[model samples]
Target chain A: MNDKVRNSLFYVGGTAVGFVSGFFGGGGGMLCVPLLQFGGLDAKRAHASALLVILPICIISAAIYIKNGYFDVTAVLCACIGVVLGGIVGATALDKLNGTAVSIIFALLMIAIGIKSVIA
Target chain B: MTPQHVIIIVSALGGVIGGMGMGGGTLLIPLLTLAAGLEQHLAQAINLIAFVPMSVVALVIHKNNGYVSIAKSAPIVGCAAIGAVCGSFLARYAGGYELRASFGAFLIALGLIQMYKAISAVVKKKKASKNKSAQIKVG
Candidate 1:
């Protein structure tokens, strides 16, 4: 594909991914990684790039949420503490772990959660 | 466990998942709403907020591992930021019930796809190993 075409595609696809992340408040990376891969990135690169893409998107969206008074301060603070720690551990493990196995399990977890959310 | 404890544990788990590049919000939102009894929108908002720090950490790690490409990521980030703003507004306007239902449906579809990918990968790995062993025996 031409540079113009690839650039346009990335922009359009990024917009879609960002919208999902903002609207749903999660799952943006799932879509973003695949989109990056389609745009010619390797899996690992896609995953890493997706994180970069999502960081700004999430920050922007979260700011909007906070401005709109849609968040819980206490919950967010506690969750942040835990998520930061987990992030360190997870990032460290990425190089050493079997990502496929972890992914499979995560996928299963997603299915279970999705079903429960729909029914409840 | 205390609510605080629950929040910490779940958030940590979500962080780990996010660090893995699977999007922590997939797991975080549900845990918050279902287990912690948070409102749907609130849970979603919290997930987004938590994502900021988590993604930064993960990105830094990936960068060190030589997995990130800034040139490629720039366009996507710029466009995604625009889309995120629009989506945030839309979510704010949409009703909670509708939002929850749609999110659930999205999760189901994504989950099934993930499962298929994982299973195929396992099968392929097994087959490759088997072929390697057969070659060794013949030699």
Candidate 2:
């Protein structure tokens, strides 16, 4: 896609994603990745882009939840601490791992989640 | 074709669904991938990107409404966030076929789980009412 088309799509897609993230506790990347791929992005690039877009959305949702009294500060803080540390660790792991293998493993995990969701 | 038009439509949809407590990622990813024809990883990436802003907004709303249990949610969110990073990096080198297949399977599983939860909730509610009426009659 051309820059103009891509940018436009990103904004449009971004807005929609933002709304979903706000409503659902889960992130919107599940949809975003596929859509981006459809728009001609590779899977890896799409993943990076999705994260970039979600960063702001996550912030907005967190803010809304906090304002509405849905957030437990202590819990949020603790979770943030863990998230930050885990991000670091995961990033380091990624540095040494093969991308395809990691993705396959992740895919396996997603399959499990999918199965569990269905079974439950 | 217009950015503004696309933005308005998607953001509005996202906000309404999100406000209603539906899982945004669930809806958005499908729409992006199935409807729009994006690759799976791209869909995930876009979903995450959009989530950042939406999440900030939602955090505020949830915080005010007291739906956020910091104590319980903290661990889950923390772990998931870290997991997300790990997951993202893993995707970087993964083959397209493996990713798509796995993602599709995951979606099916998630859908099933949601269906089960819905069914169970209804059942539990019915059972509780039945028990309550029985006790009342006995009394």
| Candidate 2, A39-110: lDDT as tens digits | 566655554444444554455444444443343333233233333333334444556766445444443434
Q: On residues B50-103, what C-alpha lDDT tens digit does candidate 1 reach at each position?
A: 777666766777899999988778877888998899999889888877877788
Off by over 4 Å in 2: A1-120, B1-15, B71-81, B136-139
**CAPRI quality of model 2:** incorrect
Alpha-carbon runs more than 4 Å astray in model 1: A1-7, A92-97, B137-139
Q: What's the C-alpha lDDT at position B2 in model 1?
A: 90
Residue B103 alpha-carbon offset, candidate 1, angstroms: 1.4
Whose DockQ is greatest here?
1
- State the displacement of the C-alpha of residue B78, model 1, in Å, after optimal TM-score superposition: 2.4
Residue B72, model 2, lDDT:
25
DockQ of each: 0.75, 0.05
lDDT of 2 at A19: 49
